[model samples]
Target: MDAIFNYLDNMFAHLPKTEEVVRAKNELGQMMEDKYNQLRAEGCSDNEAVGQVISEFGNLSELAEELGISNQYQSASSEDKFVSVTAAEGEAFIEKTKKAANKIGTGIAAILLGVISIIFFSGYAEGTFSPTLGGGEPNKIYIAVGLGLLFILVAFAVYLFVMTGITTEKYEIFEKKMVKLDPHYKLIIQEAKENHRPVLTRKISIGVGLILLAVAALAVSGILSEDNEALLISLVCVLLATVGVSVWLFLSGGMIQSAYDKLLNEGDYTLERRKSESVVQRWASPYWSLVVVVYLAWSFITADWSKSWIIWPISGVSFGLISTIIHAATSSKQ
Candidate 1:
C-alpha cells in the first residue's frame, strides 16, 4: 500500500494542480489503494501486490482519458502563465502582511507623536525660559532636542516602509499579474478572508470613532477662551494624538484587507483595475518623489517648518483627485 501510494505521488508530482488533475489524483489514488489491498488479501506478498497495482495502474498519460484530465495534464503547465500559490505560502503571506501593516501603522502614528513632542517640548521650554525659572538655554535645548528626535523618528519610519517593500518584493507578481489560484486553496483563502472581515469592520469603526472624538475635542477647545495658550496647545496635542491612533487603526485594518484582495483579485486589486493602474503606477513614483523634493526644499528654503507640513495634507487630498481623473480617463478610452 505504501509503495503504491508513493508511486501515485511520483506520478502526479510535476502535474499542474488544476481541478481536474486534483480530482483525478484522488480518484486514481483510491482505485490504486483498493486494487493493492485486494491483491494482498488474495495471499500475494506486499512487494508482489504493489508491483501488480503499479502494472495495472500504468501511468497518468495512459489513464488521462478515464480521469478526465487529458487536456489539462498535457497543456496546463505549458500554456498557463498565471502565477500559482501554495496554501502554506498564502497563509504565510497573510501573516507577513499583517505584521507589516502593524509596523507601518505604528510608524505613521510615531510621526504624529514626534510632531506632538516637538510642539510640547518647545512650548514648555519657551514658557519657562526666563532667568528665574530656568534660563534662555532651555528654549534652544528643547527645540534642538525635539527636532533631533523628530528627524530620527521619521528616518526610522521610512526605513520600515522601505524594508517592508523589499521583503515582500517576490510576492509582487500577484499584484502585477493575474493569479490562477489552485482550486484546493480557494476555499481556504476565502475562509480566512471571511473570518478576518468582522475584525476589519470593527477596526475601521473604531478608527472613525476616534477621529470624531478628536474633532469634538477641537470644538471644546474652540469654545474656551483663546487667552489660555497652554490649554489650547494641550488640547491641540491631544487632538493630534487621537488622530494618530485613528490612522493606525485604519491602516492596520486596510492592509490586511488589501492582502485578501490581492489573493482574490477583488476590490482595488481586481484584474481590470490592475491593468488600468499600470498607467497610474508610472505616474505615482515620480509624483511622490517630486512632492518629497518640493516639501524639503520649501521647508528649508523658507525656514518655515509649521506651514511646510501642510503640503502633505494638500498633496494627499489632491492625489486622490488626480488618480481618480486618470482612472476615469483611461477606463473611458477603453
Candidate 2:
C-alpha cells in the first residue's frame, strides 16, 4: 500500500500541480487502492497485489492522455529529478540518526566529564590518593591519575564518534542529493517530530537553565567562599559538569530534529537551500575538520577544558555566518 502511494507521488512529483492534476492524482490513488484490495481478497499476497496493481496502472505519464492531463505531464518533463524515499529507508534513516545522536551525546558528555575528573583529582581531592594506591609519600599522584583517566575517557569518546560516522555513512546520499519523502511517510515523520517536539523544547530550556545555574553557583561560591579553596574547586567542577549535561541535551535533541528536517526538506535542507548551499557545503567538510584539529590542539596544549569547549559554540556560530555570506555572494553572482 505504501509502495503504491510512493509510486504515485513520484509519478506526479514533477507536474505543475494544477487543479486537474491534483484531482487526477487523488482519483488514481483511489482506483489503485481499490484494485489492490480486490487482488488481496482474491488471495494475492501483499507484494503480489501491489505489483499487479502497479503493472496494470502503469505510470502517470502513460495514463496522462487517458486521464486528460497530458499537458501537465508533457510540460513537467524538463523538471529536475527528486529522489523518493521508501518507508523502510525513511524508518531506517530516522532510527540510525537517533542512535547516532545518543552516541554523539554520550561522547560529548564523556569529554566534558573527563575534563572535570582532572579538576576533581588535582583540585580539592589533591593528595587524596597515595602514589601507588599503597602507603607512599602522598604527592599529587592523583593529578597523574586524573590525566590518565582523562585520556582514557577521551579515547572512548573518540571511538563512539567514529562508530557513529560508520553507521550513518550509508545515509550520506540523502544529504548529498535532493530527496522527497512520500506523503504517507511525511505524515509519519511529521507526527513523530511533533510528538518529540515538546520533549526537545523542554530539554533545551532546562539545559540552558542548568548552564546558567552552574555559572551562578560558581560566582556565588567565588564571592562568598573566597577563603574556602575546597568549596571553590567543587563549585567550578559543578559548573563544568552542569555545562556538560546541558550540552549533551542540546546535541541529542538537535540531532533528532535535524533528521526530520532533512527528510521533510524544511529548515536548512529545503530544495532551494540545498541547491544554493551545494557549493557552501563543500566548504563545510574541511571547515569542521579544522575545528576538530583546533579543538584537540587547544585542549591538549593548554589542558584547559574549561575554556577549550567555548571554541565549539563560537566556531558553530561563526561558520553559520560565514556560510550564509558565501551563499549570498555566490547566489548574487548568478
Candidate 3:
C-alpha cells in the first residue's frame, strides 16, 4: 500500500498542488490498495497481485482527465487543454505595473508641485514677480501660498481617487490562494531567466542612467544660470525626461519580477506572505491620509514650507514601524 501510494505521488508530481488533485490522489490510492489486497487473498503471489492491481487500475491519462488535472499533461486533443497559469499571472503582473506607474506619477507630481510652489511663493514674497503688487507684501505672499496649497491638495485628492480603484483590483489578484507550480515549471523558468533577464537588466540600467543624466544636467543648469526663468524651464525639461524613464522602468521591471514570482511560487500571492500583507494593506491608506492632514495643517499654521518637507520621510518610517507592530501583535494573539 505504501509502495502504491508512492507510485501515485510520483505519477501526479507534475500537476499543480490543488485541493481537488490531492483528494483524487488519496481516493485513488485507497481503491488501488483494496484491489491489491483482494488479489492477494485469491491465492496470487505478491508480484502477481501488484501487477494485476496496477493493470486493472488502467492508464493515468484518462483518470487525470477525469480529475481535471489533464491541463498539466500534454495531449493530442486541444480542446481538453486549458490555458497556462502563467498567462493569467502575466495579466496580473501587467495590472501591477500600471498600479506602480500611477503611484510613481503621483509621488513625482506632488514633489514637483511642492518645489514649484515654494519657489513661486518665495519669489513672490521678495517681489520677483509683479512689482506692482506692493513688492512682496505679506498679504500677497499669503494669498499666493494659499493658492499653491489648494493646488497641491487637489492633486492629492485626484491621485487618491484614480489609484484607489487600481490598487483594489491589483489586491484582488494577490488575495487568491495560489497553487504550487507544476514540476516542469522550473524548466520554463530556467529558460526565461537565461533569455529575458539580461535584456531586462540592460533596459533598467539605461532607464536609470537617463534619469541620472537628466538630474545632473538640471543641477548644472541651475548652478550656472543667474536667471530664475531660464532655470525654471530647464527644471521642467529635466522633470519630463525623468518621468519618461521612470515609466519605462516601472513597466519593464515589474513584468520581470512577476515572471520570477510565478516560476518560484513565491511573492505576495503565496499563502504565508499574503497573510501579513493583508494586515498591512488594511491600515496603510488611512494612516497615510492622517499623516497628510497633519503635514498640511502644520505647514499652514507655522508658515514654514521649507521644514515641512521632513514630514514625508518621517511618516514613511513610522508607517513601517506601525506595520511591524501590528504584525507582531496579531501573530502573538494567533
lDDT of each: 0.75, 0.78, 0.61
Regions of candidate 1 where Cα sits further than 4 Å from its true position: 1-81, 125-138, 297-308
Sort every candidate by lDDT, greatest first. 2, 1, 3
Model 1: per-residue Cα lDDT over 144-244, one tens digit each: 88778878888888888888888787788877766656543554566678898999899889988986887687677778765666676677677778878
Can you list the residue pairs that collide in candidate 1? none
- Which has the greatest TM-score? 1
Question: In lDDT terms, which candidate is top?
Answer: 2
How far residue 146's Cα lies from its native spot in candidate 2, in Å, is: 1.9
Candidate with the larger TM-score of 2 and 3:
2
Which lDDT tens digits does candidate 2 get at residues 1-334?
8888987886688777777878888999999999999999999998778777776775556767766777765654546445679889988898999899889889988877887787677652333233334334463576678778889999999999999999999898777566766555566676788898998999999999998888798788889877776676677678777877887899788888888888877776776677677878788889999998998798678755445756866897899899889878866776
Alpha-carbon lDDT of model 3:
0.61
What alpha-carbon RMSD in Å does predicted model 3 have with respect to the real structure? 13.0
Number of backbone collisions per candidate: 0, 0, 0
List, residue by residue over 222-285, the lDDT tens digit for candidate 3: 7787466435554644555464556557555655565456445455445455567688888988
